[model samples]
Target: MADSIFKRYLEKKNNLIKNRGILQATYVPDVLLHRDYQIEEIVDIVAPSLNKDKPSNIIIIGQTGTGKTAVVNYVGHELERADAENKNCRYIYVNCEVIDTPYSILYNISNQIITDPNKKIPFTGWSLEKIFNELANYIDDENKIFIVVLDEIDMSFKKNGDDIFYYLTTINEMLKNSRVSIIGITNNSTFAEKFLSPRIRSRLGEEKIVFPPYTPEQLIDILKNRAEQAFYPNVLDNSVIPYCAAISAQGSGDARKALDLLRISADIAERNGDSIVTSAHVDYARQKIELDAVVEVIKTLTDQSKIVLMSIIKTPSSNDTGSVTTGEVYTTYVELSKNLGYNPLSQRMVANLISEMDMLGIITARVKSFGRGGRTKEIDVNKVSNDVFSILSSDDIFRGMNLNQKLKKQTTLM
Candidate 1:
């Protein structure tokens, strides 16, 4: 009887370990799958320009998760190593998401130059103008050639427009000693060109490069590399990682997606009390990761949008309806909103709300054309049906809802 209990315990423990997947980004090694040629091309573009005519800036463009940032980051380190003998050239990477506006971008560059670690500019929170002047002074004092990389350049442009890019590119003209060059990286190919004025565009369009998606085979190699570091010996079925790589390759050739799948698969494996990650774990992980992503995205919606989404979840045939008509969804939206204390919105306004939810990926809209008579749009809730109900009913306004009943209502509608 003791032996039997111990055997059962071992089985459960082994099942737990198998559920955990290897191959997460934070844990993955840097063996790039399909990016070798792209990396080398970028290195050539950014390598210390012998002429010192302000290291010419380069822009990299690709779809999301296509290794745009990773390639640039990897190349930056290589450039640093290659240029170690030449003290004049330096590589600096800035995530525009964090630094944000052009002033912040320039200020960050100035701080890097000052390198005091604890030093601050004397001006006490002056306007962006005064800050720029101080930053210019610092750059002039440094007497070094710096290449700054702005990742997520698209986000910066969307937030504050091209004024920052204009400033940074032109600021070097004021410097008597140091010179500045910039490398803008983005997932949006049309980002810089669309946002900048012709003159600013002219200055920045100098050396443009594009990184393409990885082939499935390449992604498989990438998965293998990450798995070696992330998993125990023979923990993952050989086919599972490749299966994940193949899925991500279809979407955007995103290494991040592949890595996320591998990690989530392992977690699922651990939860199921398995000793090895199997094909089943990978499939389950994909659905789970996708659902979680949709749920988190929906949670961030404005209260009104969430209300509109919750209304759809309770609608008849949520997916088959494509989208609930604004007219159809508005009544439920209002009831939920009133319970939540929001003033009911007009149908025209509800139309806007539908669009907002569509943008958040919580729902999709289908417009029915009435020839010249006009059009009516319908809405469909996508992947967040389970959580949308929870968010809406969590408020006292939805206190009477029986979750099982609501679920049944959803079933009947579908």
Candidate 2:
């Protein structure tokens, strides 16, 4: 019998990564560097729960990858440990991004507190009011202080409106034996002011803590800590960690991005059978990460927004730089929408969609004054990759459409 093809691949040893999970964004380490102040503040607020008192509802605000979730997770773990003897406290964490709707959010919390299989809430079919009542009753029955952490709280608010917030913030009024304190973690600092009413805002934002982005130095310390645990000694070049940190700091100071860069760089090196990960590997990882992020964002765009983006892509530039005016994009959009047998949106709507894409980094829209022509946005697609074109073409609406021919048609019209 022939040797199995997998045998050779399986025989290859992993020299770089000692423990891969340590490098992941989800891994909560024994120690979190550079977040002592934030951790202490959260600890102070939740300390009252140890004595069977309801702690203040907290709003933890920070940009992505600034360690908001990690700090909260760390504090919850510590809080659980301190209350291990009393058994009067319980910590429940629900990621609002996943369990988004009020029904699912309430259902998730109820199940966590209610241990009996027969007593647990069903996944669906119940009205929001019934689910809230059931969750409230279950928690009150347990008679324990529940500190619920709602991570990415703004996502749920944006999707389902403020009803969930109103229910959760006012839940305490409905409970008697048990007390529920909410700790909302959000990337948007203005989430409270923008989407929430004054009453809901006051209750939910009882206390707010903002986490600032990490500096390059702080990022380096974070990378060093993770690198020691993630990679074998001497497997990473001295310059690799600093390169990843510098690149991430230049963008959003996102430690998660820095960690991802390091992890992917090492993986790339290992795949190539290289002994040491280098700056070149980090560069390749950066490009791969950026392309993946852009593609994912493009995938989630609304169908109308996708068509508007396609219109921008097909529209011929007035100059050699491959940039088109918003008016040109709208013209192409009208034609494309008609070709696909879809109703064309107003020019104003198409222009707004273009601006949204620009904000998402898929395209660049710059304002240019044509004097008597007034002001207009000059759209550029230099940042978009071939992969994006493939994704757009794969859509059922755009499958049979001749995008190139449409481009030529727009050129002829111009």
Candidate 3:
């Protein structure tokens, strides 16, 4: 079956991509475009790790896809190569968003440094204190400099609490010979003041790097540099790169989103058997990329959040209003939870969750004047592809919702 499917795919013509991986945001290039200054500062900050000395704990804050993580990864790669002596130095990169808990983060760091499997802590069941002690012991025994990079560090604090941050920042004090230094990355540039407590803020204040969004011109340069390696010569039209960059710049100036647009455009071109990628391919790719993003975000929401979102989607707005009030959403949520065999949360708690969902860009919650003398917060789901309903509704909890009933319940939300 694999051979037959692959043979058919291989026989297809009009393959536009020379190397699709190059267009992915995850792919780190030896030379990062338009981020030289930030890279220089990062290199200076982390250079001491190569000498088996603890580098300063760094907080890199920026808008999404401004090359914060990429720069850290790039610096880590170079720092490792600089350690030609293999002086028992270690460079560990863990996305805190993935490994959120203090226990799991410590266990992972311990696992990376411990050469003997018998000495490693298991994934669960160990007390966080035990893991921290053992991890510190390993670092002390190994006499290594652990240069740890935690991407999306802000999200970790929000979800799992900053107790982990407190531990990571202070782990070095317990070690006599070995040291651990953090290079934390966050999307919120104001995370230090807004999200972090005073004590936590003090620990992470050792060094700070702010990554600004790319300008349209700078984004175009980045796209072109990546495109040379991502696509075959003459396989992409001249307008494709500019179009993707402009669109991305108008939004968040997100390099990742731009790259995604380019990658998906090439895919659509290849799938449609086109000789070269054009503006039309870019247009369709943008639509697909947006839809995929919405689907992914929906998939990540917790069951309760998903149910809350469903309630909002199902609650029809009255009086030709564009959106329903929080009260209307909670009433509908109560109905949704009961139908799904779950107890409903308090209205106040649901209102708070609604605000969180608003912050997530999943829904637009806003306060506006309702009448000459009244005001209330209104909420409506974001405009997403119709296919998103199917994706969200396919979840086991949502799966039982009859399609006809769903259509009948569909609110005029965008």
Candidate 4:
């Protein structure tokens, strides 16, 4: 008498993870905790839309996982109650991180609003301008209010431009009846402050809400609420939520990270044949989560950026200062690019990537000066070099490169 593979797998899985999806960042609980003021404020901002009037545009500024997206989604859908004329008001959400291009953003919105598959603009055939025109036409025809929530909206500006935003803000003038307004959610408010032109900034900044990082106690409450729903009874120890909450709060009160830590610790505990998630499980889960995040960032990097990172990793760590100079990194980057038969980016662009990667916490970089003459950044690979090396080595362009061998190989050949 042998058990089937499926039977064994199910039995093991059922030991934990009663509902894995509940723990995901995307899982929007019916109610959010400790955000009633934000909820009421957001509702009040978009309230005019209930009467078919254009609502005030909003820029929701918050550190990651303070419930920015959940609040808007909850409020947007609730606000979509039909008007007196039976106009079908809508809440359309777009993750600018995914739909980062102008053409793609317009196409997604067009497809969502256009009911007829045939009448919908061909995904490829329409010029971006014509697509924009057609998108505006379709929405105007609906004569309904549309509230668009652009999450990670900063990414859209970086990848594309402010053109789509400009159009959204001004599109109402083109419409005879319908109104389209945007609620932008972003992790970096400074991007808006620095990058957006004054005209666009003022338009979107009409009303702004900033969600501060959750206090440790707030995170504990949030994790506790989510854990109750995500795990079966007695699955988590009383201290588990508090520990995860404290760790996450230390890193800017990221509730999403808290949820992830909690969920992953449960999985780790379950895999270890433990019935209850414990604090040690949380520590192990934190390491895995952090490494996974860096791996993801590395994977999404452009080939040039990957090589740029590889250059920094391959540069010999300074014994005296423990960091490489920008010049040293650039030299390594150029050599590696030429080694792989790819033209290297200009030193300026490589420097820019260094700054970007530094911001991503991949490296530590600070400017140093040669008195009265010049300056360059002193760059040190953070402890995540192992994770970075692993991810880059897996990619085709970066294959066959090893930090230990890279310096030796280039030294011998050059």
Per TM-score, the best of the predicted structures is 2
Tens-digit per-residue lDDT, 257-360, candidate 2: 99999999998999888999999999889888887887789888998999998887777777977788999989989988888888999988888888898899
**Model 2 TM-score (2 dp):** 0.85
lDDT of 1: 0.73
Better of 2 and 4 by TM-score: 2
> In order, what lDDT does every prediction score?
0.73, 0.87, 0.81, 0.83
> By TM-score, highest first, what's the ranking?
2, 1, 3, 4
Measured by lDDT, the strongest candidate is: 2
Which of candidates 3 and 4 is the stronger one according to lDDT? Answer: 4
lDDT at 101, model 1: 71
Off by over 4 Å in 2: 301-353, 371-377, 390-414
| lDDT of each residue in 59-102, candidate 1, tens digit only | 88888888887777777777677667766666778898988876
Over 20-108, each residue of candidate 3 has an lDDT whose tens digit, in order, gives 77987668776778888999998898777777777888888889988888888888888787885777567899988888777777887
Question: TM-scores for all candidates?
Answer: 0.83, 0.85, 0.78, 0.77
Clashing pairs in 2: none
Off by over 4 Å in 3: 1-10, 50-53, 86-88, 296-414
Worst 10 residues of 1 by lDDT: 405-414
Model 4: CA > 4 A from native:
1-13, 82-85, 297-414
